[model samples]
Target: MRGVPGRLRPRSLRTRLVLIATVLATAAVLVCQATGLTLMRSWLIGQVDDRLTDFRPPSPVFRDIADGTAPVRRPPPHEALPSDFRVYFYDAEGRLLPDSLGSGRSEPRLARTIGDGLPEDGRPATVPAEDGDGDWRVVADPGPDGMRAVVALPLDSVRDATSRLLWFSLAVGAVTAAGVVLLGGAAVSLGLRPLTRVEHTARSITSGELEQNVADTSPDTEVGRLGLAFNTMLDQLRAALHRKDRTERGLRRFMADAGHELRTPLTSLQGFAELLLHDPHMSRSRRREAHELIAQNADRMSRLVDSLFLLAKLGDAPTTEHGPVDLLSLAADGIAASAVRHPARRVTLAPLTAGGVGDSGELDVVEGRGDPHQLAQVLSNLLDNACTHTPPGARLQVRVGSLRAGPRTGGTERPGRTGANPPLPSGTPVHVVEVADDGPGLSPQDAQQVFDRFYRAPPAAGVSGDSGSGLGLAIASTIAEAHGGRLELDTGPGEGCTFRLLLPAGRP
Candidate 1:
């Protein structure tokens, strides 16, 4: 019951268009038909009135009848006058003249009505028939000797003609309206086909078919433009859904990994505390060792929790104090730290330009805009990751340079940048810091998501039990992005890995 109006209404666009067009066309046709019929009926009635006005009786006979001088034989009214016409006579005193024209067939007895009201003027007028048959177009004519004669023509023929034409016009109008509806519906459907396709695509997408796309993307027509926009929206929505799914999966994995990491430390702390509590006869040295172990595990859990909190903050909106930073200086510091941390590994700063090799003074200063502390941390993390994954004595190089004109800032590669030296506008210099290491490079699959939180690649074959939490690279990536920079990895199996941090250069 609630849906009755919805079901009865023209809900579809095509139906509404056709229905509206047909209604308007039908109205216009009806108006024209009415106008034409009215004019034609008026003209027909005018002709009848003209005939009535021009009517004349036989002059001699009328004069004789007026003078009452001759009683000559005369034809009856029906025989003398046209079949559809009648005649009535009146004396000078406006009284009916009965048996005036040898009244045969008694011409509907209109004498009293015509004689009482009709004037001696030669104009026609319409009056009701005395016999109640129909209307009559009557005109009064003044004869000789103050005599008056009235001529009336029945309007039945005009009425019948107009009636026939009205029905005919209605029939033709109905046919034309039907044609308009059929043809208009077809045209409207054809015109709306692109929109229909877009609707179908949208429906399919709502049903979890994210790959659906509208086909008509031409920019020529309105529907074509709509299709293009619809397709673009679909693409964006699909990408958003993919990002959401990926994010959900990553969150689940992060929870699992964080729990596992925290659980180990918690278990260690619990076990050590229980040992100290239960072992009343234990030696002082053993109790102190247990206390130290508990503290270490507690510290590990605290660090893990801190990393998780930091990641949450970074993921939402990371706030940083910006300043001019020298990538070269940061790279040098990272190299030095790596050397001290992994004493056996050789860590050095590599010169980017041809002029300098093994000399820090000769290299150009790669200045950028970022939080100095965050940038330093990113460099440190990259270096540490390199040393942790590589074997001892592996040579790691930190290369820093500035591109005079290169890809745009924020890691978007400019179009038509196929050449090694692509022509680009020179402004907003970009700083590049590469931390390259001679280690087992990540597989393609691993490199794809290396920056994801809690994601860790398999350690090198010789390395075992690397106890580092995997938030270093993820945090570094987030910080770089927060500073409007990006960290990219260029690596392949057996080719070693190069983690490149690109930052927008700042004014010195």
Candidate 2:
């Protein structure tokens, strides 16, 4: 037979609260018990003292005495005292005196009182004593003619009374303590009710109810503070969510604009090329010109497609590897290549004394493992953008170095220019790469939007034809992000534009 599995039991909050309250209540009861015991003991002792002080022995009679004045009968020994009191008499030297209690039913009480002495008050000194049958309160006193007297009363009656009262008090105290514990637990649970409400509200908020706020009946308490903090967090989250929505909308609009722009060029190029192919009797020069046009348009379309592909890849691809890729060397190589490709344009390389590299001596590689090919694509886009934008004979300068440590560079704007050269803030270290040109720079308005996809700056005066797909800077910016860096533009109406790329030198 299968053994029965034990059922899981849920813990009770009320029970825990009751237990805590009960422990404290029990402690309080114990303290009260101890205090009562002490007070009762003292009162009982005081009662005994009072009884002894108030007690008096019966007066001696002369009828049975041989000499009336001498009380010859000597009060029959213990005969001077009442039936409830056992009496003994002693001489001035403190020696035991005779007593009649020896032949009475109170002989045991008499025996216990034998050795007692009288106090200075001519009254008996009360002493605690026991005779097998029960406890006794014995008192000793002086008698006439240098004699002493002693008396005793059984303590059983007083003891019984005190014991009954003590037991009653203990019973009452136990009941009161239990009641207090129960009441205290209930009070605690009621006081914490607001917290439970807050918990419920928080759970509701987690289910996308951002507008819900914790109910605050008491504003001056901890629960109120918690509610306020929660509301504040919710406010911030709502704002962030709104901003994210806006950004997504803007990206979608930009993608649509890019698609529209690409479609126009593609349709024109296709139609023109097909027209040229259908003419069989075309002259050699005309055919050559048609062929060149087709080639140029096809190349332009290819470049556009390549830019879009690069942007999409940068946006989605994960960076997982990092290693040194010498930006300085890469810059020199790019300039040499561009110079050779476009011999008409002047390209200059301003080499710093030291090359910028990662802190680990790996050429400021994107620290985390990332695709090197993508990183190179980013640099290539930046260099190509500078080459294409600048006019022939313009001097292009590339600088690769580390950012100066300390105090941020701050600037507003230059006259007639939209670009600003802000100083690097203090204590912000970075690897800096600059690509500058001597051609007329972009306007302030254009500079801000230059990195946006499908955005093209208005052509400068005297430039012949529209030559770019407007994705150069956008693609470059995307590449920079993949490398954990930013591409910024500095340009003005008169001043040449400077594109600065800053990458962190340390591990991400």
Candidate 3:
């Protein structure tokens, strides 16, 4: 008994729904059956009472009595009564008349208990049978001379009819309840098919099938909406996992590249130091050359370490300071520096015209918000990469301007310069600085990974200069992203390269 509640408790949604539906249906059936039985019994008893009250004698004696004529002093002849019925007579003193009783059948003898306190009024009532067989419907009819006649109808037929009906209703109710359980279970299971699919998809994902997705993602019903939401969540999770994997791969590659870059300079420095320490008697000029080589390697190592540290800092906190900066001025400065560093290269700076083309227009201060120092580094890196990688006498031009950057649509021209696609509402004003060079550009493979740390394009023929650390373009790109901007490249083999720096345009 202690475990009965636990056993009856519905553990699943399907069970609970079917159980509740079946119970309600059963209750409804019981209530209807009970009401029907009560009404049927009342109607049947009413029918019995009517028959008893409507009874009449066939020998003219009852008609005479009903007409207020006194009954003969002697008892009337015993006439046969109707089916399942009996009749009796009483005197003015309430005494049973001799030989007055008659019945349609035998075995169910009328009890004396019924005649002892008979009703004087003309109404119907119930009385018991002598053999304890059943109850009877009794009615008393008054006559002249303080006399009355009594009639009784046995209730066996009414009981039998009601009993049979009760059994039939019980059988039907039981069948209906069973049908409710079976059909209700089937309907509930059908409704939960989407949930079942979701469960299967979840299990598949848990078992390392990352691409598994629910198939019933319609947006109409509640279950459909649930499936749609689950599918959406799964897609997002899959994308997040992919991004995580990519990030981890990039980190590992960065570390390996950093170690390799540092190892080269460290090896050179160690060799030079060992030579200087072990060969103390070497010529003074050779010793001085060794010292210079050591200094050069040390400086290279220092630059590599500084670039790695800067990249790390950017990763942690991309931008530490912000201020208004003029891209036009920054470009001019970078061109001047590039001209000084690579005297043979033709470097120039110009402003872009309002028509989305570069020209000899008067320089306009294309301003943006960022750390001036970092922005300067980005411009310097672009100029250096252009001048150092391109052939000697390559024309390197820097163009700076402000324009509304629109959504990317796979166009060759820069944003706001394309006529094929319209701009989106998210278009914003940005200062674009283009460092373009007419030199043998990189191949498609090299151009794709130009912004990756330690990635370098093969130098053009007759192009000889300090390649410096490969972190220049990578650092520039990082700084641009940190400032809520981006650095893009357009190039192909022999088409020349254009490194475009786009930054948000603002003064505050």
Candidate 4:
């Protein structure tokens, strides 16, 4: 993090959180300050008003003045004046009496809004000055004559105190807000430590260290949940990467095998062509053999190339353009073809009706939707595999039909098992076409990898001619999978192999 560039680093979630907390703290501080200022002002003014009402002027002053025996004694200036207190008297004509000190200077006319207001007995009212500096709260009482005695408090001291309080509040609020921001930022950073770890883990992953995972913490909290999800995602990524690595390895091996297969035919063709070119005195039979060798090698290379192309096409998810294919017809045709190709072998087609039968009978029909061309290829490959692995006169049969799902007399089967499929959901039906031969069956290990490209087991006795590229079953498997079906192998050593092609039944 110290060496990381600013623009590339992730934005801080902590800063935003701290800012919001500080703003809220500031608002709370402001509210408390305002309330405190308001209450202080009110309480001070109430004290001033009480003082004005309770403090009696010299006892004979009011009566003597009314009797015209003596002049009124003004309230002492030091007791009230400098502290922002003063006195006033207004006659019936609303003229201020001369001795009244309503203003520090002598030009004493009251503002009209304040002059017209009469004080209620217990309440004092504030009057404002036009200069925007000092203001007054006035309390009025009845004098001996048709006159009103009013006491005025300047409100300057209260204003001064509040002004000082405001500044003090601001200082304290500033300190508190700073503290909140600092402490909150620290707390947030600590709280977000898991996210930081997640970030570090991500960086390590990008740097090719995929094993790094966020350390486990509390599951009930937000960051903990995020860490959990992050680790899960990492696990998925690692698994996908592992699969990719395996696929690449498989791809390399496949290419190596394909190259080896092609090289043999190419080498033979080259040698034969070279021999024909170099031999000027070659016999007719020898020359003919050379040409035959060329053609044969060419054929071998062509088949291998064609098989490769077909496997590639299957990988591309070639379109099915499916229609109902007759499994019985397909089996019969494959068996007939195999019979012609290996006349020494006995290949037969049998059909099972409602219940499975041991012997051939009237052919039964079952249908599924798939590309017939591809399906035929699947059947042909199974027949060919059986022929290559079995004895010269081995017994081979192709059977096709439908079977009801659910509640079989015996346990149902999975791939590599010589039994029926697990009973389909109740009332369902499955169409199956199978090729079984009396050749040596496969061991469990071989059966598992039998569908892999270019695999070859030991050839049977008297098996001659070009051994296949081993792509037949692999291509067949791909085709079956693409059709939403499966090509399953049921074979074990000495018992022979049965390839069951199970397909979803076409709608009636």
Candidate 5:
């Protein structure tokens, strides 16, 4: 047999509301019914007690016969006792007296024993008995001549009344519960109407309607508070959308300017190439000049295109990778390469002693599962940036070390000391790399925007213009994020800037 498909079944709000209301109403009705039944039972018992008190024998002759002072004989006519009741007389010898009116069945032995013990003051005593049909209550009182008078009342009438009352009350409670459920469902739906409106409004906003706001004019209630919160969220969303739009427009304009820059170089290269091709008979010095012009412009255009491609790739690269990387080695290689590329700049490395999770002298070598190439690119970008912005012969310091941080600590130990205690163990490691320059640093405002793409600081006084593609720091930041690390800059006007890269140094 095929199995049934598993799917979520949504419950109707109306039905749920109705069911809840019905449960509450049923509980209340049951409480009321129980109380009513208790009082009704008490009232019925009192009525039965009063009837027993007021019972009397039929006549003087019948009373005499019941007392056993007269012989068995026919008695005078007498009115009947109440419905469900019967009268019987028995003598002191336990024989049926002549005035008895019920069927000829013998009196119960318990009823006779009760009659015999009746007080002379005529106080009635009640005893249980059964008529030919069902159970009855028998009350016995002594007469003046040693005879006893007994009256019996059937219980069927009271039982029938109680049963009818119970059924009727149940019917009424069920009807009331149904009414409450219906009305309660409608009320709940009306109460939730504002939430429905808010949901629709949010959907509309998500479908490109940025100016929409939730309705906030309702009375002060939970729905009103919800509406107010929704309106505030829309306001924040609007501001975010505006910022995103501005960024997109700025990016378009930047691309246009870059395109113009590339086009100018290409146009110059093409014009010079055509001139050299058509003027093969020209002088050697003129030909050499034309070729140099073409080559220089072509080289410049290639560099610009390469920078643009690098920035685009950085922006679009995936942020997750799965492979172990040696961060320490990567940083060392990047610093050495950048120093070689910028021969005039001075680059220095400070060795870090690892002392935590592992005992290795280096902090677990800052091993992590990531893309090494991307990490190297990030380091290269930071280094290139430091070289380009700082003055010639400026000292660039790169330091790597481990520190104690985070919630847990573990690892091996490495033997070393800066001053007093040996270096920390390996497992308890937090890797950090700081790249500082002793050149003119950025102002506070410039430092804040330095990591933003296409942002460059104002020209420094008494120095040649900066040579940069303006995306180096931004690309570095993107790479840091991919490795679950952060790139932070510390700088102020006239105080050199230090760029720090902090990452966890352990197995991920």
Candidate 6:
């Protein structure tokens, strides 16, 4: 690799495939030609033997030769001893006697080939002619009057025909080889077109254009399936990389926001600590004020860290322990705490009114399956979000109940209902809770990203640090979703804001 150039290296798959196909095709053609030649030669030799087997010597000549009279000499070309066949005779004593078709010029070799009499098995045998002119297919058999007859046919015509055929076959094979080279190359290229596109797109990816994708092909073909699968993998890889990029960007932003939030409290603590340290004679009241400020900022920092950690855990850890929890009791506890914490705040608990609604007089109970503590945390965060944003005189309502989305009046009965107990229609179940406040609500833009981490609502004049952290709604939303529920905000400018939370019910 170091000494050789890249182009000279045999790295192309298509070239290898085409080369293999051409070689195999050429070999196949050669085998066919060889088989055809062999079969043709056998067929020609069989025809010669068949003619010799059926041949009969002239009756007068056969009798004369058998009785010791002189045999006839070679005839004229038109009547020349069956064209090229040389007929011979032999006495029962194994003496060679010539008849039609004189072969004095090549008699000895022919005699040696024919022998003194007819062969016992009587099959034709091919042997070289005298003077080594060409091949001959000779047969010997018993003729009339105890005389043995031998016939020899020169193979010159068959050799010539075969030679010509061989030449023609060679020419055809050469042409076929050339055709294979040409057509095989073209076919291989066409078959691998999708792979070529994949290679091009892969090269582009190497050059940092990861957005480029190979074109998809049909799934029925091998190369097409390969291309489609590769493109799918590329799509998935691209999506994963994009998600990683967004995550990195979000992480950077989160760190920046965390640093900015932490800096305020840290700076405050440092200033207060320095004041206490540097001024030993400072006034007691001033010293107490610094202490309280320091404590408050310390608590804020701790809470921010805890919120960030909780969000991180939501993704990394498995879900919390879950079971049936009474939703009504959780809501009441959270709402009561919020009202007590803000003594002047008007927090009201309202009965949820809907078909198949909970009965307040009968101590309506709605049970949701989840980790009780986490669910309580979700309720508390929602209350805090509402309390901090709502004005002091604003009315806040905690609404809870169940609702059926479709066919509310069906004949089906609710869970735990028996014929003796009550006939509540069996229906699909859904749990709903709403935290509503009659106060200045968020604008559309703010409401859109209200659950986004680090999102801060538009500031009001008298807002406290309770709304400063900006992670309560985001955490609460994540917690709700983690419990197979979702928190959605329905608010507009000047309209009272309501945070609607929906949870999965017994029915899908």
lDDT of each: 0.75, 0.63, 0.76, 0.74, 0.66, 0.74
Top model number, lDDT: 3
Model 4: per-residue Cα lDDT over 1-508, one tens digit each? 7666876644767876888889899889989998999999889888877877775444355555445566555554454445444666555555565555433532222533325656664467777754655777777766665656667766777889989999999998999899998899889898878788888878988998889888855699887888888888989998999999999999999999999999999999989888988987999999998888899889989999999999998888664578878777888788788878877888877875456656757776676778999999989988888887777776888887776533341114444463222333444566778788877778887876788889997776766765688999888888877776667777788888878777767443
**Model 1 lDDT per residue over 1-508, tens place:** 9989988997778888999999999999899999999999999999998887776877676667666687545575556654566666777777766534433333443546443566547878777766766677878887776767778777888889999999988998899899998888889898888788888878987898878788888899888899888888877987898899998987798899988888899999889988978888999899888888888888878978888888788778764577777777888887887778877778878766424335454577777777788788889889889888876656788888765434432233443211112123445466778788778787878777677667788888777655477888888888877776667776778778877776666533
Per-residue CA lDDT of model 6 for 1-508, tens digit only, reads 6767767756789778877887788888888988999999999989998988888677677777776567566655565443666777776666776454444344324453335334553689777766787778878777666667777777877899889889988888888889988998899899887788888888999899988876757788887788788888889999999999999999998898889989999999999999999999999999999999999999999999999998888767525687888888988898788878777777777667564333253436888787778778778888888888877767788878777532232212333111111122334466767788878887767776777778888765566656768888877777776766656666667777877666668622
What ranges in model 1 sit over 4 Å off?
Answer: 1-29, 57-63, 70-84, 89-120, 143-147, 171-234, 326-351, 354-357, 360-366, 386-399, 404-428, 436-452, 455-467, 490-498, 506-508
What is the TM-score (0 to 1) of candidate 6?
A: 0.81
lDDT for model 3, on a 0 to 1 scale?
0.76
Estimated TM-score per prediction?
Answer: 0.76, 0.52, 0.74, 0.81, 0.50, 0.81
Once fitted onto the true fold, the runs of candidate 3 whose alpha carbons sit more than 4 angstroms away are 1-25, 52-80, 83-154, 177-227, 269-295, 320-323, 333-346, 354-359, 404-429, 504-508
Among these predicted structures, which one has the highest TM-score? Answer: 6
Provide C-alpha RMSD values for all models, in order: 5.5, 10.9, 6.0, 5.3, 12.1, 7.1
Question: By summed lDDT, which 10 consecutive residues of candidate 4 come out lowest?
Answer: 105-114
Query: How close to the true structure is residue 86 of candidate 2, measured as C-alpha lDDT?
Result: 57
In the predicted model 3, the residue pairs found to clash are none
* Candidate 5 Cα outliers beyond 4 Å, as residue runs: 1-240, 243-247, 274-282, 352-369, 404-430, 459-466
Pitting candidate 3 against candidate 5, the one with the higher TM-score is: 3
Task: Kindly give the stretch of ten consecutive residues in candidate 1 with the minimal lDDT sum.
Answer: 415-424
Give lDDT: candidate 4, residue 128.
Answer: 72
